[model samples]
Target: MNNSFSPRTGSPQAGSQQVGSQQVGRLYGVGVGPGDPELMTVKAIRTIAACPVVAYFCKRGTKGHARRIASDAITAEHEELPMVYPVTVELPPDHPDYGRQIEAFFDESAERIAVHLAAGRSVAALNEGDPFFYGSFMHLFLRLASRFPTEVIPGVTSMVSSASLLPRPLMLRDDVLSVIPGTLDEESLVRTLRHTDAAVVMKLGQNLPKVRRAIAAAGLADRAWYVERASMAEQRVLPFAEAPDTAPYFSQIVIPGEGKRG
Candidate 1:
């Protein structure tokens, strides 16, 4: 039941004759955008629809969200490779070997994906949001780029999606934009917010209190907006003054006018 992945090894056999004649297989890192299937870009849809095989990252025992987003665009003839990420915090702390075990999983996944690429089959690996924005697809990209012909297709990112759901613009004319991870330490967060025009703090699940203090210290508390599950049916957007005691993992805090100082 433990989910894990290992780097792929060796190349896949050449695909059908017609594809083989093309002489080169392509690896596509396709971004599927946020949770909505309709939000996918035209380029991303076209690349995935044409590829012979489609790959996606998923933990064991769960359906692949990215695949579902692009399901309508894919044909039954394509292949699905679900690279698993088995590392979960639920495992006992004393397991000791968990870290190494997880690393091996990624290695194996990369290797498995490489096989399909070696063949003349173009592989489209689906990603949630933009491929490069905190997505696991980056790991596969790093593994396969040097070994094969790879292309990255950008998609709408969660930050942008979240901002769009809000009534106010994320940034107005001449406003600075600062994107900070909530995981930053108190000092770092405060320093980063001091001179920014507008700010977005991502990954606010457990760091809400710290981030709130930093915003208060920077004197930008009133300008903040808290948004959770943006663009989805369960979305919630509230001003900083009315935000809950804790924010969800998918939540973000935005300060639209803070950029005027810079």
Candidate 2:
């Protein structure tokens, strides 16, 4: 692999000089925020501006939400790496092929980013929410962190964004809040909902119907709120029962806690 790299020029050009005897580029896992570009943290913006190479994950034929959110910071002078996924929600998560394909994709992605780090070019991987909280950046961080100087800048999460748009607090004093994924089996979802004082169900795309059934089964459908694209231009807030049969990947259901306080 070529260890020589230049600061800019689209790709790694001719540059033999290293910063030190064995200098590697720094890695930054930057969370751009839930949906609104304004939600991005100041540090995230600064870091994206400073990085020579800006990396982000995207589906085929898409600019990606994270990349779009940080478009202002990414200038023509920066090298942009768009890591496209081999598959996304096409196959069941439990399928053996799904795991194999996704694992290979992550492996290839890590190597691609590793090339930049090896060439002494600082690369910032853009994440939509907190890097460690169900963010794709965690996969890259796991593979490249020990190999380079790394920093993770947190951003506001979708849960927080949805909560802010709600009429009541997501959780009140002494209220236990559970963050559950709508992908859970119906029985599991119902059981979890029955036990938690409050909850936020994420990943509600094709699972919306199943999640709705679970909410009803748990007897919380009346209190549940369905929020779509929270804090974005297309945001929609409605009661869970009124929600349509479908929901986007960006949508979620919020069940606020009712703990009383003086």
Candidate 3:
């Protein structure tokens, strides 16, 4: 091959400057919505369907929540990538290796996504809730944003979805709504729940017992309403005081606002 000039074009340039810039693939972190496919925004559907590749986070051997919610838009033609977590509750969140293991998993997942981006293939990652709100997709977005083109499409969060099931309004006048995770310590949970106008406690799996106790201690037991699987077909709604022996991973406990903004 010639050292530096385009033989056919006869131009005095380094391979004709690569004949314009190469097409770069766009990376989209799309929030698939709480649970129901109907809740998925039109923009989300278009963005997801436009991408040639779709990626989602899932437990080992499982298809994942977001993937299931967005199945209507994703066809068999699109390549699916499942970013399985290296560790879940098996190791405590406080463990030193816990962070390391998760960090490694995200790092590897980002690399895998990057490969597709480099290949000029658009990729969309499906997230259950809003992608920016405490979602696993943020880790990958932060890693790849600086290096490639990335966009985030918002989705309905479980906080509002769970609130919709209640007869009372989540907020009335100047009421504030606070969302807390069940992973918080009992003392912290009580403190936060006691001060908030309305509260939604999420990530309720094995932490249901502790969260139930915290809601009682915070004096919001009667006000609190427990919702399991917000928009799914098997959704369950009940009083927080009646928390069952077992709750699924997607449960939410909501305390509707009392309209005390006056």
Highest lDDT model number: 2
Worst ten in a row by lDDT for model 1: 5-14
Residue-by-residue lDDT tens digits, candidate 1, 177-209: 889999899999999999788889988877899
Model 3 Cα shift for residue 41 (angstroms): 0.8
After superposing all C-alphas onto the true structure, candidate 3 shows an RMSD in angstroms of: 8.8
State how far residue 138 of model 2 sits from its true place (Å). 1.3
Every candidate's lDDT = 0.79, 0.86, 0.84
After best superposition, candidate 1 residue 192: deviation in angstroms? 0.7
Q: Candidate 2, residue 191: CA error in Å?
A: 1.5
Better of 1 and 3 by lDDT: 3
lDDT of 1 at 68: 76
Model 2 global lDDT (CA atoms, 0 to 1)? 0.86
What digit string (tens of lDDT, one per residue) describes model 2 on residues 1-262? 4433322212222222254587677778888889899999888888877778999999999989999999988899899999998887588877899999999999999999989888878888999978988999989988987766677788899999998888899988888999998888999999999998889999998899999999999999888999999989999999887898889878889999998453
TM agreement with the true structure for every prediction: 0.83, 0.89, 0.88
What is the number of residue pairs that collide in model 2? 0
lDDT of 3 by residue, 1-262 (tens): 5634232222111111221376556778888889999999887898877888899999998899999999999898899999998898689878999999999999999999989877778788898889998887899888998776677788999888989999999998888788898889999999998888998888888788999889889889889898988898989999876778667878889899989856
